[model samples]
Target: MKPVYITRTCQIANDQLVMDGVEAVLDYKEIIADPALRRRMSRIVKMGVACGLKCIEGLTPESIDAIITATGFGCLADTEKFIESIVANSERLLNPTPFIQSTFNTIGGQIALLRGIHSYNVTYAHRGLSFESALIDAAMQVNEGKKNVLLGAIDEITASSADIQRRLGMTREYELGEGANFFVLNATASGNKSAAVLDIDTRSGRLTDDKLIEWIVETANRNGIEISDLCIVANCNTATTDNIKKRLSLKNKPLQFKTCDYPTLSARALDFAINNSTANKTLIISDYQHINHSLILLGRG
Candidate 1:
């Protein structure tokens, strides 16, 4: 299949989650130009829409063929608030605003409405692989002859969600954070300025070191490159990194972005790789629960 190009990108990460070498969190504007609608939507919705608008800057909204979003915990802040109201008011006469905006697909729906775009819109909620799933769908759409696709990942941490994450052992070494990262993808480069996504692969369940190494080798060979020619970027701790490197006998250390929460981990790693001009060929690896992994290969064509 022909590679899809990333024409534009807009990333909004939690301030503390951003890597030291990368740009800081995006300064998102609270108001969305429409006063009436601005008063109804939640922060997450506005944030996602802002990133979406930025991604499609200088382009017509009608040019977009689809809008896909992935969120681990969607509208968590509003969810918590709505739950609190339900508990306080005996689940009667509660404000519908919170409940309406708390859906996992709200971001995609809101973007579609705001832009008057009536195209294919979808959302994915596949835990750690949510963003990867959305990316996969967008790529598939492009492969199927769709011209332009808009996709993103939005996840936020609330007091309720934070406590749950702690109990689930998801915040052991990484700090809880939030983000809304958006991108515009096309079948070909818009004006010879886009980055090509060579391939993407995601795995679930148990995986051995040999199998992991083999997958990397096969993917690199398919792209006409060697392991040494690609820079590995992963969201992993020192121990995990050491295990992978020692097992694969890798000399080039992978760029680690393990300090943030799940939703922004892989997105931030990709942001770093794209922004770093010195990196020629980049490979992104997201290791979830030390078992399931998602790998992506990107380069300039």
Candidate 2:
């Protein structure tokens, strides 16, 4: 298979959402303050379009082939409000707006509706692996010969979801936040860019320290590269996977690994990999543990 080129990428965080390397056009906190569902949806779609425009300047909406999104908790604040309204109103005369905006695919649908894109539309909700799944699907679509694909990952933190995460021992002890990350992919260069996508793969199961290291090494070997060639490693900051750090140290490959400080900060790693990439390659490996789930691989295309 040929390499899949990344045309552009964008991110929306609490204080900032960047397109390519530039700051986003809108602030996430300001958008969340809007009470109306339709207004919120419109704001999100607008921000997406703005970012898309910045990434692929002068590209028309008609050129996009598909829209795919990965959301860990879609419209979480609305979902919580709807549930609260049910309890507050004794399950009577409930407002439908919250429920309507709470669907997982709402963002993707809004984007398509605004852009008039009618091709492959998909939304994945696999906890932390949500973004990875969306990225995998986007790559597959491009590999299948789609010229351009719009891909994004969004997650909003609400008090209710944070409470659940606390009970499940997934969130940190302090506050919770929200954010979105979007990207565009193409089979051929959208313009004159020449980035290469080396390879990507994921695994799910009980993997030991030795097994994880071997898997990563084998994955790199498949692409005709070695751990030594790896300049950086991006991973999630989860205590359960301390062994991964130890194994990397053992390899002594003189590589740098950045552990996302914020839960959604993994997108920051994506930005780093794209901006700071050198020698035509970079590897992004996300290891998520949910009932023994994991996502591992190298990305360069």
Candidate 3:
């Protein structure tokens, strides 16, 4: 696959907005003009829509060729409401709003509806690999001659969802957190801090430490990058990263990027590497719930 350039980035998390590695005012009214419509949107929807709009603010609708989004738990609040309504009303006379907005494509659909972008639009709802799947599609779109591909990932924490996940033992290492991340990808671009997605690989089930080491070396070797020279951004845990470094005999320690766990946290890791990594090439190693794993190689293009 061809390398897709990350031209712009925007994120909203912990009640803060960052664009292109710079802190900015997060005024939703400024991004979403219609007051009534804004009032109707859920937290996740507003966050995703606002972050995505801010990402493609300067670009025209004609310039945007596609809108792709990913989410692990799609619209938790609205889905909960819809389900609760169903249960309370005895399966009758339910409010249509929550059910209407509970789909996984809401973010991408809203962005396209607001921007009048009549191009390819899609969404991915894979467990922990949601963002990576969306990213792979976006890169393929760019390689297929698309421009200004708007790709985003969003997940919001709700009280009910958090309790259920805890019962399911998902919070053993990290608590449930929520954030929205948007990136603009294209085939060609020139600017400062220029970066591109060089390669990506994903796997399921259990991955051993030694197997992970072999995967890392193979990814680097195939890309013509030395394992020692690549700066590793750990999106899993400090202990795992430290072990990988020790076994590989890497001189530079891996940078810790994961504090809390989320399905789309790898998107944040990519954003961090794009802005903070000083190395010419960076590798993001992500381990999600010891079940889903992925490696994304980023390079300065």
Off by over 4 Å in 3: none
Candidate 2's displacement at residue 88, Å, is 1.9
Off by over 4 Å in 1: 15-31, 191-193, 208-210, 247-252
lDDT of each: 0.75, 0.60, 0.92
Model 2 lDDT per residue over 25-133, tens place? 6643343344453364533343443444344345566788778877665676778778999999999999887787778787777666655677888988876567667
Candidates sorted on TM-score, descending: 3, 1, 2
Superior candidate under TM-score, 2 versus 3: 3
Backbone clash pairs for candidate 1 read none
Scanning candidate 1 in windows of ten residues, the lowest lDDT window is 15-24
User: What is the lDDT ranking, best to worst?
Assistant: 3, 1, 2
Candidate 1 C-alpha lDDT tens digits along 100-147: 999999889988887788889999988778888998899998998886
Candidate 3 local lDDT, 84-145, one digit each (tens): 99999999988899998999999999999999999999999998999999999999999999
| Best by the TM-score measure | 3
- At residue 231, give the lDDT of candidate 2: 54
Q: What is the C-alpha RMSD of each candidate to the true structure, in Å?
A: 3.0, 4.2, 0.9
Q: What would the TM-scores of all predictions be?
A: 0.89, 0.80, 0.98
Error of 1 at 152 (Å): 0.4
Best by lDDT: 3
Where does candidate 3 clash, by residue pair?
none
